[model samples]
Target: MSETTSKYKAPALERGLDILELLSEQDEAISKKDMVAKLGRSVNELYRMLAILEARGYITTEPESGKYRLTLKMFELSNKFPPMQRLLNAAGTEMAKLSEKTQQSCHLSVLHDAEMVVIAVQDSPYKMGFCIRLSARIDVHGSGSGFAMLAFQPEDQRRAILEASETPEPVIESVLSQMDKVRQKGYFIGASPQISGVTNISYPIFNSNRQVEAVLTMPFLTLNSDSLHHQVVSFEESRLAVADAADNLIHAIGGCTPE
Candidate 1:
């Protein structure tokens, strides 16, 4: 928490938020006992908050297991925010077009607290394709989208993001070198660190102030010889297509790319 935020405390609200955050991080619904142990709060203390959250439709309890899990309410609420809504509207058409053209899956990601959160995704119009789930959190040092956005940030802002990263110093140094290459090329094309045989191509989307607002990434997959949907465009063509889609989104939002 920041100093400014700490000055005003709302204990009840904090407990509610803490519960939500903890649930969001879990892969499966968690029991109240586990929640109490993880949050360091008594079951009595969290009981009312959990009930309120469940009542408000932010979370739900499984009837069989009696465990708590998040609902789609938060994601739906976030989509209603005007700025995020606008970004989605601008990217939707272009992202679809890019996926259709390249026959590959693509996603748009924005920086959030030193991580990249996937906001929108478009699956390829092919029988076999890859798609990342919405709201997926990606490591800043491990994704091409992260490098594309970080490489274009102003020196001070870039330094701040790097300073906030938990990556080891040696790995950070190596990532910095890659970012330099991304800056020189004005985009990123690299093998994915998390998945094998998939190349990542990413371009930075800028706002009116010439600051990077998001990154558009295409996870290019090579088709097997027996696959029905063979690659239509060359690798360079798909990369350029992703760049064009990013540019189109910027134009749609009345934004600009830096010279």
Candidate 2:
């Protein structure tokens, strides 16, 4: 409540923040000498700030080269806020429930920089199943979640994503027909041509604008298909489970279904 405390500032904290901001703008690490040149500060001035940041696990220094770059701590912290945090909380719960019931590995994906990035993954309840790593990027045309998202998006936006990739993402008649089917059926169920014995089932999660906000996918697999313990889940069963999960997720986050 004191007037002086409200206006008080820490110059050291400000300098450390400046370094973090600068490092974030770079695609690669920055050397101490280069950092000084870019920051227009003496080495001594920034040395302590760098030391503290590194010690606190905010920035990391390369062993081979004395260059420094930011760590994932900031990104992890940021995911605790808006849209993404809200999404994770809701999707995690739904994905867990889906996986438990279906005994199938599932993941939540979002379109990032023209690619589908897996944000969260839930393992199958079975002893043997596959789980995708967090932050893995998948091809827009080749992945179930990727294709599912693109199928629901506006045509122009989809076109832009395809055009932006240097390697031409193949557009085939079958894929086109499948997209039409996905839109019509409200879900996608198909075998992944790239991965044998793995079926990809995807559902679109909507936002307040009734636009496709994310894709919820189950990379279905049979562990010991011949084993009498596991019962085969039908395509219709998978579709309904994923669809219900998406709907429950929408309610959790106060979102809408696509129009």
Candidate 3:
């Protein structure tokens, strides 16, 4: 907690938020007993907070297990926020077009603190395609989309993110070198370090002030030769399509590339 946050205290609100945060990190529903243990709070104190959250539809109870889990309410609320809404509106059509043109899934990500978060994604039109889930958090120094966004940031901001990274020093140095190349090439195209047989193509989307606003990424997957759709999009084609989609989204959002 920051000094400013500590200065102004709201015990009830903090408890509620803590519960929400805990639930968000959990992959399975948690019982009230588990929540109490995890939060280190007494059952008496959490009962009301849980009831309020459940009543407000921010959380729901699993009928059979009688455990609590988060609902989609928070995600829905985030999409209604103005800036995110604008970004989504601008990128939605272009992302769809990119997928249709490249026959590969595409996603839009923005930097949030030291990490990148997928805010929007468009699945490929084909039955077999690579798709990243919305709201997935990605390592800032470990992805093509991360490099694309970081390559264009103001030097001080980039340095700050690098300083906060937990990656090994040697890996961070390599990523820095890769970011320089991304700046020179105006995009990134490489095999994914996390997955086999997948190529990542990414472009930085800039705002009107020529600041990177987001990264548009296509995880290109080569389809099997025996598949019904034998037409394979070449690497060059996917790169061009992704670049064009990034350009279109920037235009739609009234953004401009650095001169």
- On TM-score, the leading prediction is 3
Q: Give the per-residue lDDT digits (tens) of candidate 1, residues 64-110.
A: 99999999999899889876787899888999999889889999999
Query: For each candidate, C-alpha RMSD in Å?
Result: 3.0, 8.6, 2.7
Model 2 C-alpha lDDT per residue in residues 1-259, reported as the tens digit of each score:
1112346788777678779888987889989998988877888989999999999999999999989999999988979778778889888788989988887889999998778988899998877787888878888778888778878876676677766644354573345546766788787778886789888988888878877778999887855647756586765687789889988987777788766
Q: Cα miss at 14, model 3 (Å)?
A: 2.1
TM-score of 2: 0.73
- Span of 10 residues, lowest total lDDT, candidate 2: 1-10
Which regions of candidate 2 are displaced past 4 Å? 1-57, 60-72, 167-177, 223-226, 230-232
Q: Which runs of model 1 end up more than 4 angstroms from their true locations?
A: 1-9, 27-30, 62-67, 224-231
Distance from true position, residue 125, model 1, in Å?
2.3
| Model 2 accuracy (lDDT, Cα) | 0.81
lDDT of each: 0.87, 0.81, 0.86
| TM-score on alpha carbons, each prediction | 0.86, 0.73, 0.88
RMSD value for candidate 3? 2.7
**CA error at residue 118 for candidate 3, angstroms:** 1.3
